[model samples]
Structure formats: structure tokens, C-alpha cells
Target: MSAAHRPGLRVNAALIIPESELSWRFSRSSGPGGQGVNTADSRVELVWDVANSAILPTLQRERLFERLGGRLVDGVLTIAASEHRAQLRNRDAARERLATLVADALRPPAPPRRATKVSRGAKERRLTAKKQRTDVKRLRRPPTD
Candidate 1:
């Protein structure tokens, strides 16, 4: 982030990443820009180095890296936005995406589920239903001579 930009990005109330750590690049977007599409650099690519982040807590940083390992390339994560026609909107979109990805990756994994046996009452109900079906089928057959 340059002196031109005052406010930094706010990922959450607890976590804030300084704009200085963020890198932005703009390119001619392949998306809608009417006749100006070829000339306008509306596409925004936001890159952040998670490995060297200063704001992230140690535990959360490890969890984020572990969870986002496949997405990160050489400890850097890049998000590109071209959905909007304006460069500012695309930049915002990219930053929002980055925040969401970081927040999701930092979350703890859900606990594993343990295998459970069928309850005794449920087993008994199943057997009773089978017995009723057998009785009904037997009644449906003609009397044996």
C-alpha cells in the first residue's frame, strides 16, 4: 500500500492485514467494458504473502497455511477479479475474495465422527416389522390341502 491509500483492508474485527503487505496489478479485462474493453485495465489481481504476514497469530497462521496449501504457490496467494467493468470494483472484489479465503482457511477442522451402533429399540422395531410382513404374506397364501 502507498501513502495515497489511507485505510487498509479489514478481514475481520480481530484480524486486519495492512495494505502495505498487499500487492495489486491491473490488466485489460476480458469482461464487459463496451467499446472500451480492449483499452480499459479493469481486471485486478491481488497478491498476498501469507508466510511472512505479521498480523496473523502463530496458530491461525499454521492452520491457514495447512488448509490452503494446495491453493498457495510458493507461500503466496493471488486472487483475480474481472467480473466488474470498473477497476475499483474489481479491486474490491479481489480483496474481499482474499479475506474470505483467509478466514475460511484459518478455521479449525471439524472433529471426526465416531461410528455408532444401531440402538436396541430400533433393532427391535425392525424385527417386529419383518414379523408382521411374514404374517401378512403367510395369510395371503391359500390354505395347504
Candidate 2:
């Protein structure tokens, strides 16, 4: 498939990818569906170079790297889709999936959570409960002389 078709359906307008940036390969699909599966090269694999992307900022690239981790090899982000029986459909699906992934990566995440200490009242309640449990267990034991 060509980049123009994929570009028109991109989720993020800010992400303008060059035609050469995307690489796609088609393979025969696997799974149920008998004859159709054997004849169709419906499996689509779309790979994008995240480290060298012209559209993404440095921060966005870092975030994507952190989120995708081991799944991203070198600098490339790979997406595969084969749910459809047609190569074109699978190709579109793969591109759509990549768009969503990139859009998600662009969004800023909530700041890291600050560590919090237990409130004094809560600590007191816990201690009180522990003392009550100790008293109950002591009562259960036979009375010591």
C-alpha cells in the first residue's frame, strides 16, 4: 500500500510521516477460514522507525520507547494486523493501530505518585485493633495462675 492512503486516515495530524518511513510486508494469513486463508496474503506488518521519526519530538520518542520497551527493536515500532481476509483491509488495520499507538504515546502521562505515610489516626486504629486481638487471644488461652 502507498503512504498517501495511510496518511489520510492518521489519527494525529501533528504526526506527519514520510512515505519512506513506513515499511510493509504481506504474508499468508493463518487460522480458520479454509481456502481463503491459503490463497490470501492478508497478514500485514507495518514497521515505523521511532528513533528516526521526523514527526515525533524527542520527548515523545522517549515516552514511546519507555512504553513499548522490549517490543520495539532498535528504533522501529512494528504493528501487525490479520483479522481481515483481504490484504488491503489488513494493511489499513495495521496503519490504524500504529496511528493509535503514536497518538497515545504523544499524550502526557500523570506525574509520578508521591509516597504517603499512614495518618496518625489510622496508625492508632491499627494498634488498637491489634491490642484487642491480643486480648481476645489471651482470653482464649487457659487462665495462668
Candidate 3:
């Protein structure tokens, strides 16, 4: 089925953004369509208002704002696709891009790394290797009377 007919864009197992939340804007594409490039509106821009979406829970909404701050303008995220000559293909591309981007941003932050100290055995091995290297260099020097 075409992306236009889908009920919503599924960002993850828990988050599905309804079609009503997505808006599209199109314009003439800049490349590869030969004679049709100038007239065909193959470039697609998909915009979603992250701040106003009804589907998002409060925590998820705040996470989206925090993770996607650089990309969001007035709490809206926009995805653009122009690589395809067909409008429908461009639409699909834009949809996929939007889904991937939102999914990534919605992901939970990774747990903090725990600090670790070097093991005694590892420190001993390192010191042994250094001492071996020093002995080898001493052996290389010419013997004095």
C-alpha cells in the first residue's frame, strides 16, 4: 500500500504518529528527470509538529524536544526527499526518513559507563614488558672495559 494510505507512521513498537499529524509540501525537483524535472513536483517535504501531536506521551514529547532540538523549528520536524523522479517515490523516501529520524530521537539514552581500575595482573604484565625492553636496549649497547 502507498504511504499515503497508511493509518500512521510507526516510529517504534510503542509510538505511531497518526496521518493527521503529518503535512506534505512539494515543489519541482532539481535533478535527473530530464524534460520533466522543471515541471514535475517530485521533491517532497514531510513536516510533523512534535510539540502538538496528540499521540505522544508527556515524557516522550520532552525526549523528542531534547534529542531533536537542533532539527526542530518551533517544535516541528521536517524531512525532505528529492532523489526520486516520481512524486510517490519521493513521498515514500520522505516518510522513511521521518520514521527513522523520529525513532532514533525517541530512543532512550544509554546507561552511564561505570569506572574501572586496571587489574593487578595486567599492570604486572605491562611492567614486565617494559623491563624486558629496557634489558634488551642495555644489551645492545657496547660493553665498557
Candidate 4:
């Protein structure tokens, strides 16, 4: 958290990442723009250093670090969006993706699974099946004493 508690690039009311923490790269989009594609950079790549970001609270930082570690490269998460023909749209897409990714990563972990025991009827059925298989095998063998 910054000393002045300023917020930027609002993902939601609860999660506001500062603009200074985000960086962007723009390039020519590869599809569907026709004449505009030659001159405009419609592809947007938004990069955020998630591991070292001060915007995240301690618990959220830990959750993001643990859950999204595999998706991050050198602790930086990059989201690229080029589906839209306009640069602004692509930029918004990237931002939305980043927000979604971060929000999902920061979600709380599921509760631990409780141990379960087999019911009496289930155990009896399993034993019955094993006995039937054993009896069939025994019956198939030679009857010589």
C-alpha cells in the first residue's frame, strides 16, 4: 500500500491497482482490420508485476502468488488482447482479462476434504463380489482330489 492511499486502474471497488504498477506494449494486430491494420497498433499487452505489487493486501498477495504462480513469468503477469479491431478496445480487453485473472487468483482456497468411511452395505457388497469371483475361479479348476 502506498503512503497516500491513492487508487488507479480500478478493477472493482475492492481491488484497485495503481496505474504506476501497470505497463503496456502495443503492436500491429494480425487479423480483420483491413486498411486500418497497416497503420494502427491494435494489439495490446498489459503487464503487471503481481508478486511485488503493493496494491494487493497481504492475504490477496499470498493467494495470488500461490494460485497464479504458474501463469506468471518472472513474477510479472502479461495479458495480450488483439481480438478487437480498435486499439482502445484491445486495451480494455487486456485490462478486463488482467482484472479477472487477478480476482480469480485472489479468491480463497476451498475447504479441506473430510475423511469418509465405507458404509456396511457397500463393504458387504464388495466382499460378496470377491467371494463370487473366487468361487467361480475355484469351480473352473479341475475337480481331482
Q: Which candidate is the best by lDDT?
A: 3
In model 1, the runs with Cα more than 4 Å from the true position are: 1-6, 130-145
The global C-alpha lDDT for each of the candidates, from Candidate 1 onward, is: 0.86, 0.82, 0.92, 0.84
Candidate 2 local distance difference test against the native: 0.82
lDDT of 1 at 115: 97
**Residue 43 in candidate 2, Cα distance off native in Å:** 0.6
Q: What's model 1's TM-score?
A: 0.80
- Model 3 weakest 10-residue run by lDDT: 2-11
Q: Candidate 2's residue-wise lDDT over 37-141, tens digit each?
A: 998788999988888877777787888899887779998888999898888888778877987887877777889999999999999999999999999998899
Q: Which ranges in model 2 have alpha carbons more than 4 Å from their true place? A: 1-20, 65-69, 107-110, 142-145
lDDT of 4 at 124: 100
lDDT of 4 at 19: 82
lDDT of 4 by residue, 17-92 (tens): 8888988899998978789998998899999998789878788877877888888898888999999998878877
Write candidate 1's Cα lDDT for 22-100 as tens digits. Answer: 9998999895568888988998999999889888888987887899999889888899999999888888789889989
Steric clash count of candidate 4: 0
Off by over 4 Å in 4: 1-7, 116-145
TM-score of predicted model 4? 0.70
User: Candidate 3: which stretches are off by over 4 Å?
Assistant: 140-145
Between candidates 1 and 4, name the one with more favorable lDDT.
1
User: By TM-score, highest first, what's the ranking?
Assistant: 3, 1, 2, 4
